[model samples]
Target: MDFQFLGGASEIGSLGLVVRDQGRTLLFDYGMTPTDPPSYPQPAPPTIDVAVLSHAHLDHSGMTPILSRLPKARLVATPVTLAVANLLTRDALKIARLEGYLAPFTTNDISSYGSRATAVDRHGTFRHRGIEIEFTPAGHIPGASMTLYRGAKDILFTGDLQTIPTHLVGGAESVECDVLVMESTYAGKEHPDRKETERRFRDKVAETIARGGKVIVPAFAVGRAQEVLMALASSGFETYLDGMARAVNSIYLSAPEYLRDSKRFRHALDGVHVIEHPSERKKALREGEVIVTTGGMLDGGPVLYYVGELYRDANSSILLTGYQVDGSNGRQLLDEGTMTIDDTTIRPMCEIGKFDFSAHAGHSDLVRFAESTRAETVVLMHGDRRELLRDALSGFADVILPANGPSFTIE
Candidate 1:
């Protein structure tokens, strides 16, 4: 089998991989880095038999819509993944337009996706033209999956895995394979205890509220926002949700099977206020005790609006709940004590805080999960510090640290 990475082999964004075996060609994921102008993977090969999406995250499923143009390629993912991916891809197009960047795929391409897509359940198998692939939960978010391709050699591709369970989903399940392709996003890092972290987060919220100030939590719409909401469910704060996360919540609610606890999930949303339109922003600003909005990195979205109104208020706070990529506004705030909104840099007088609500498995967790796979060859991808994991796994397996645009063969 011949394997190659088009991108995201040495870094955490814009991930793609191609595998060719026994006259069949497969693409694992094709994604783009959602930065200022955005960065994309190499153009896909002219022909492909199947394209498997492990999750709906933009770094994994952003470019799958373009695959609809390929006459013979069939896109496969869990039903929840397909629905969420559709929502995200459309949102990406709108963002591209607002930012004055030409989107790679047309709206028509996204609409045609349903024709080319095959919705496989998390525990189901997909087979076409002698090609076989199986799905298992990845635990980063609800409906996220790790794919197993049963070819000449059983190869398992883990797309953004988390070994520890969160309020939204269970931990990733292990499967034995000959070759294991795993993500190393936290290759040299370990998260703080989840329960402890949540306690601190809620305590901070209460402190801000007790001080007669509103808390603005900027979170990623897909997984981070929902996780934060679940954490705040019992607090009885006047929480108001905003941005694309509202739409994402609806999709997750429709697919109850994808969530860890459907009843609890619904109960969590019941007590909170939903900002249905931009016209309600002022009402939320005046009434809400905690506002959880989208654009997790503080790069773009309704978060800017809330920050603009509350930045000068020393009593208010902006709490970030996701990874801040380099050059993002959130990183600037943490590093320089300032952020830019609409081309104007502003130093916020509001209190600033960050919590570890990350969904990726850390260094020790990665090593344990890799060992449990029992694979002879371990290929690590999707992190800047993958060497840390490579060294850790050296004695247990033939650890291969690959770079983008390179091909390696293993039999």
Candidate 2:
């Protein structure tokens, strides 16, 4: 079997890989690195039989439209993933146009991608040419999957795994394979206990509301936003869903089985007030309600508008609920005590707090997964801390850290 790391080998984004066995070629994922001007994977192989998508996150599915050019390339994903990917792709295009950056693909390409997509269920086995493929629940998001390929050799590709269950989805499905390709997003870090983190998050929201102050939670639209809303609702706090999160929340309701507790999730969605327009958002800010909005890293979106209004008010508070990438607005706020909006930098009087609501598995979880799988060879990707992950998995298997554009053959 020949395995090639196209992208997502040395960094946290642009995850892609190529596998060849028995004269058959399969592409795992073709995503783009999330930067000011996004970077895509090197050109795909001239011929691709199938392109398997693990999830709809931009970092994993951003460059999927590129597959449209391959006449024989058929996209394999879950129903929810295809639905969510379309929404996210359009959003990415809009952002690129607004920021004066050239988009990698056009809307027509996305349409072609959709027409060629083939939805598969979890654990269902399918064969294209000489390769057999199966997808299991990854527990990262609504339609995330851990892909398994059986060809010349058994290989497993874990796309952003999360061992710990969240309110939105259950934990990852543990599977055994000969060669394991895994993500190490939280290689060197340990997340706070889920129960304790939830308690603290709930308490902070309640306290801010009790003091007649609004609590703004900046979360990712897809997974983090839903999880935060569920947490807030379960804790007896009234939350207002704003920005693209409202649209995402509605989409979540369409696929009930993808969630942990469909009824509970729907209840939580019903409990929150959906802010549809700028006027409604402005009105929501005037009240002391807890608001959960998009732009998790606080780079843009309705969260910024909320920040602009509440930053000057000492009574309000902003709660960051995810990992803030370096040089992002969230990181700037956390590190330098200020947020830069167009041309001005604002030193907010309101309190700023960060909570580890990460969906990726932590260092301990990664170690446990590797030990349990017991693969002969393990390759780590989608993380900056490769050394930490290598050391942790050294005792379990032969750890291989391959860079982009290299093919390692298993003998």
Candidate 3:
């Protein structure tokens, strides 16, 4: 089999992988990085036979809409992934227009995707013209999956993975394969204990609220926002939620089978207030003790509005719930204590903090997961520090660190 990456072989975003065997071509996880101007993977080959999506995160499903235009390409994902990806891709288009950047696909393309796509269950097998792929749960978010392609050789492709269970999802389980293609996003890093982290996060929120200040939580709408909401559930904090996560919540609620505990999930959301419209944002600001909003990196969305209004209050706090990509407004705030708003930079007087709520496996966890897969050959992708993982895995399997745009044969 011949393997190649269109992008994201050496970085954390703009991921695309192509595999050719027996004259059939397959693509996995076409994505784009939502940066300042945004970055995309190289255009997919028009001859692709099948494309599989692992999840709804922008960096994994961002570029899937364009695949609708390919004559021979058919897309596959779980029902929940398809629904959430539809919402996210449309929102991405809106953001591109608002930011004045040209979008690669149109609403027509997104609208056309359903006709060319098939919704598979998390435990289902997809077969198209002799190409077979099996889906397994990937713990990053609800409906996230890892695919094992049955071809000239059995190849397992992990999109983004979390080995430990979080409040929303269970831990990812390994499947046996001859070749393993894994993500290494946290290759050189280790996360803090999740329970301890949650305790500190709740404590900080309580402290902020006790001081008569609102807690502004900047979270990613897909997974992070829901996780934070569940963590704060049953705390009687009078929390309010804003942004596209409200839509995602509806989808998740409808597809309760995808969540770890559907009943518990429903109960957790019951106490939180949902802002139904933009006009309600001011109300959320005025009445909420804890405001959970999106654009986790503070690059855009309702989060910027809350931060703008509360930055002057020394008693208020902004708690970040995910990785702040470099060059993002959140990263600027963490590094320089200043953030850009409408091209003007200002310092925030509010308390700032970050929590280790990452949805990817850490260094030791990655090693252990890879070891469990028992693959003779391992290919690491989707991380800047892939070499660290390569070194750790070299003794167990032949490790290959492929670069974007290069094809290598695996035998």
**1-411, model 1: which lDDT tens digit per residue?**
999998999998889999999999999988888898988999899899999999999999899889988888899999889998999999999999999999999899999976789999999999999999999999999899999999999999999999999999999989999999999999999999999999999999999999989999999999999999999998899999999988889989999998999898999999889998899999999999999998898888899999999999898899999999899999999999999988899999999999999999999999999999999999999999999999999998999989899799998
Clashing pairs in 1: none
Listed per candidate, the RMSD to the true structure in angstroms reads 0.7, 1.3, 0.8
lDDT of each: 0.93, 0.87, 0.93
Off by over 4 Å in 1: none
Instruction: Give one clash count per candidate, in the order shown.
Output: 0, 0, 0
Which digits, one per residue and each the tens of the lDDT, describe model 3 over residues 1-411? 999899999999999999999999999999999897999999999889999999999888999999988888999999999999999999989989999999999999999987789999999999989989999999999999999999989999999999999989999998999999999999989999999999999999999999989999999999899999999989889899999999999999999888989888898899999998889988888889999998999999989899989999999999999998889999999999999999999899999999989999999999999999999999999999999999999999999999999799998
TM-score of each: 0.99, 0.97, 0.99
Candidate 1 clashes: the total is: 0
Those runs of model 2 whose alpha carbons end farther than 4 Å from true positions after fitting are none
Candidate 3: segments with Cα more than 4 A from true spot: none
Pairs with steric clashes in candidate 3 = none
TM-score of 3: 0.99
